[model samples]
Target: MEFSWLNWLYTAIAQVITWIHQAYSTFITPSSGLNWVLTIVTLTVLMRILIFPLFLKQMRSSKKMQELAPKVQELRKRYKDDKQRLNQEVMALYQGAGANPLGGCLPILAQFPIFISMFTVLNAIADPKRVSVFGMPADVVASAREAHIFSAGISDHFFSTQSVTSKIIIGFFVATSSLTTFLTVRQSVTRSIEQMPDNPMAQQQKILMYISPLFAFFSLNFPLGLILYWVTTNLWTLGQQHWYYSRHPMPKFDERGRLIPVEPKPGLLAKLRKSEPAPAEEPPPAKPEPKVVRNQPTRQPRSKRTGSKKS
Candidate 1:
């Protein structure tokens, strides 16, 4: 079942990519490497737009996790000796609050298949014999093979190509991608620490802050087109996160990881919520009437006035 779903996903992604390439080919010179480059960037934009709701969910989940940090810390300290109990309590807390500790990872994980499919498509495009998709034409395939950036083929990798041009293009992609990733991670961690200085997750964030760039560098051998795709997406994430943080700063925390009691300024979403009217609550159902008693006794006036007059 999973394989079937994944196959469907890849097929769908291939269709979208091919459609975009064809659209670009209509007006742009297909022979120009710049045309393919622009197509990849445009594809990234469309994908981001589609997955934006996932991003919003991630943001909300992250904020919820942040809000629960203090409780998590308390759990850690309280159950420091019993690791099992600590784990149980943490899970319980997350579940009770309807939060997923891994919620923020949803968007990234969802994009994984799309990324792989794009890579596959680009690889196929580079090979003249294998460059056939449902709607892509022979002319587009020929054009893709001719597409070159800085004299390096769009699908060329550092290890596969002998040209200095390939090396330079790959190097530029690696450097920019790594740099942007580092900046994004650093900015995120710094803000998180500001909101909760004592955040128990600080250590994990610290590790990621250093390791993310390393991961980016490791992708140096990926196709120039894919690297370009990554660079564009990373740049988008960098800007989107910055905008989000500016509007909705994380809750501030003190040196000890305790939440500072300052009133939080509303974020973009919060402002929208504040502006909208609340839903009207439904009225409670009316209570049933009590049953009447059967055959109840009736009262009568006394006849003592005639006896007093006779006396």
Candidate 2:
């Protein structure tokens, strides 16, 4: 290939892979299988860390949207059949509430390029034509290529092998990836519904949630590396969803279509009330009185009585 921009991109990705290999070699034992396993795990962790701030922003934006859903639906109902008015009302509502429906999506959209780059790097590293690292031979490289983070024989069919084992491995990965994606999408939609107002819009969202996963399943079969990426992303999303929902329970909505803070449960309040009252503050102890000398007063009294008797 000519040394074009694309070629440089590939070279840069290869360099990343090489750097990962070197990093693992230094910190991890030189065991053949262990090295590759650590590489994948380490890469996943690094990516997640890099995107942590975005993940947090996504979570906050999602919570804001959920809090705004009831008001949004009210606006939709108020502007029924008037598309322009409906959008205007929606935008106004978002603005007044200091929330944006599109903001939650920005972080996810931003991750696409990085995801593509990582996918390219992983695919390049697994290519049979790529050079082996650290004086490793072609056979060792081929063996490493054959091994997957999940299964050793999984790459056979996709890598052009015709063995029955290859078919089994490929089938497993495809099925596993699809299944994880489905579950992830299902959980997300369910959470949305739980947070949504009871209305036609909620029903529409529910339908889309179900439909989107089917689309995602068919679209993820380009490369085993991409499949891995999808699986990891889905798994990370699932964990994040669980953490978010648990920590931030859905807010209660009032008749005015505004979110209200959920009051502590009465049972919890009763328990809190039952706890012992704070101890009454004790008064500080009084200081003891000093001893008095009565002999000086007795002498003065005796001297005055003697002077009176003499007069």
Q: Which candidate is the best by TM-score?
A: 1
Candidate 2 local lDDT, 191-297, one digit each (tens)? 77777647457777767766765665553344554555566767877777676666677787788877788754344456688785978999999888888856654
Best lDDT among the predictions, by candidate number: 1
Model 1: clashing residue pairs?
A: 195-252, 195-253, 198-257
Give stretches of model 2 more than 4 Å off.
Answer: 1-13, 27-31, 130-159, 198-204, 211-221, 256-258, 263-311
Question: Which ranges of candidate 1 are over 4 A from the true structure?
Answer: 1-7, 131-135, 199-201, 253-311
lDDT of 2: 0.62
Residue 204 lDDT (model 1): 95
State each model's CA lDDT, in order: 0.79, 0.62
TM-score for each predicted model, relative to the true structure: 0.74, 0.68
Model 1 C-alpha lDDT per residue in residues 223-288, reported as the tens digit of each score: 888889999988998888877776666676787877666554677788899999999998999899
